[model samples]
Target: MRSRLLFYWISSLLVSGCTRSGSPPALSFSGGLVVAQIVTDSLQLVDPTRQRRIPLVRYFPQPGRGSAHKLKVALLNHAYHGKNTDYKFLADNLVAHGYYVISIQHELPGDEPIAMTENLYQARYPNWERGVQTIRFVLQELAQRQPQLDWQHVLLMGHSNGGDMVMLLAQEHPELRQVQQLISFDNRRVPFPRRPYPRVLSLRSIDQFADAGVLPTPAEQTQFGIELVQLPTTIHNDMWDGATEAQKQQMNAAVSHFIEKK
Candidate 1:
């Protein structure tokens, strides 16, 4: 069923020329720069038994104003109460650095906290697999649309549960072969089902998830090939909170270095 849905999506995009038609119109960001949010009405596998419209939000840097270095990044949100707001600062920073950031809002029924928590389980929520499939499908769709994009440099960035999802997806869809990097922020430790690709960066706050003492085991960490980086003073919410200007800058700098480093 997953394979059939993916085939239909690719076929539709190819028939419609979703990427080659023309440059998508640019959107204005808070700063002077322009960003583009390309929405694709392609396939969305909602659950094991159902499919829905796939919604993707993207932030593309202004074209022709800067050097053409393309990096396709997918940012996934964390658990209950998770939304793009958590990654906007980081996404904006990545846009300034000349990378296109695409994030998917998970298919939780209602925005309420309790409803989201109930849907977190893989067994209970079969849509989790579909979400993973959607990410892979979107990567291909974006590559077809943006010719200048270096498809080889795709990166996956997620927070908390989203981070765990990306890890598991990367392990499962090795055939996609486009995702070269993985970044996780403040995620609880869960055993990785299989080895992730070579480049994996896991960043956690010092006393946050780590101090909680329920992260992946040392053996599991080794097996997953994670290059774990800990931020000593930064809290789990520091990335999203209204920290001081200087504090935000410090946090942004650390994250930027990790993403932009060769």
Candidate 2:
């Protein structure tokens, strides 16, 4: 009789504990547009700066009652078939912290590789230009879709080739000059922008075999006023999706601090 009573008591306790296990947090909003198809046909060739149709993914904070100031963030993925899901953790955390993240899917199916030639810039110019135009289209859409967002708090972040693209955008787009913060994850092709412009935070990963290119040297960082954070045992791809939870959280904290910094 006592054994039967004890078993029932334990089972009840187990059920009670199971019921208290936390439910998953709500997911953020994700959506985008294909610029070329969405825009009017008259705006096609007539527009001097044109690009192939591209998709943009917006990961917005879950709807709630709060007073946190919202910022718009643009996250560009790496080159050659890279998808925006690569930066899922980064985007989700940013959303949780009151920022709207726009992930640009710059590469389309059947697109040719970025050409190589005598001029280094010429080799990658087309690819980078396409990314910039995609971002511009999304920004125009956001102006209408999210008027309450604080445009002054814009942040641009990218990984690998996407990181190179962000640097190129900073260099070529005068309209983006007002963009306040830039973050790159293991991009090697382009150097950081000129000194005293938008502040920069570069997260570098070390993998001897990859030859991921030169990040700003410490002296360069000091001269250009950029911040460089190195991950000693990290690999290139792991900097994005493959990163461990601890690694992701470390990056999230660093990014949050930089964004919140005055």
Q: Candidate 2's C-alpha lDDT?
A: 0.60
Root-mean-square deviation of each candidate, in angstroms? 12.0, 13.9
lDDT of the candidates, in the order given: 0.54, 0.60
Which candidate tops lDDT? Answer: 2
Q: How many residue pairs clash in each candidate?
A: 3, 0
Model 1: CA > 4 A from native: 1-50, 74-79, 108-127, 192-196, 210-225, 241-247
Instruction: Report how far residue 137 has shifted in candidate 2, in Å.
Output: 2.2
TM-score of each: 0.64, 0.73
For candidate 2, give the lDDT of residue 5. 9
Q: Candidate 1 lDDT, tens digit per residue, 1-262?
A: 0000000111110000112135545533223444443222222323233354445556555445544345455555544356544555566666655566776766556422322444244342344455576676666666776667767767787776666567667667777576777777765533333455646766666455432233445565577655566555557766553544544555555555556566
Tell me how many residue pairs clash in candidate 1: 3
Query: Which residue pairs in model 2 clash with each other?
Result: none
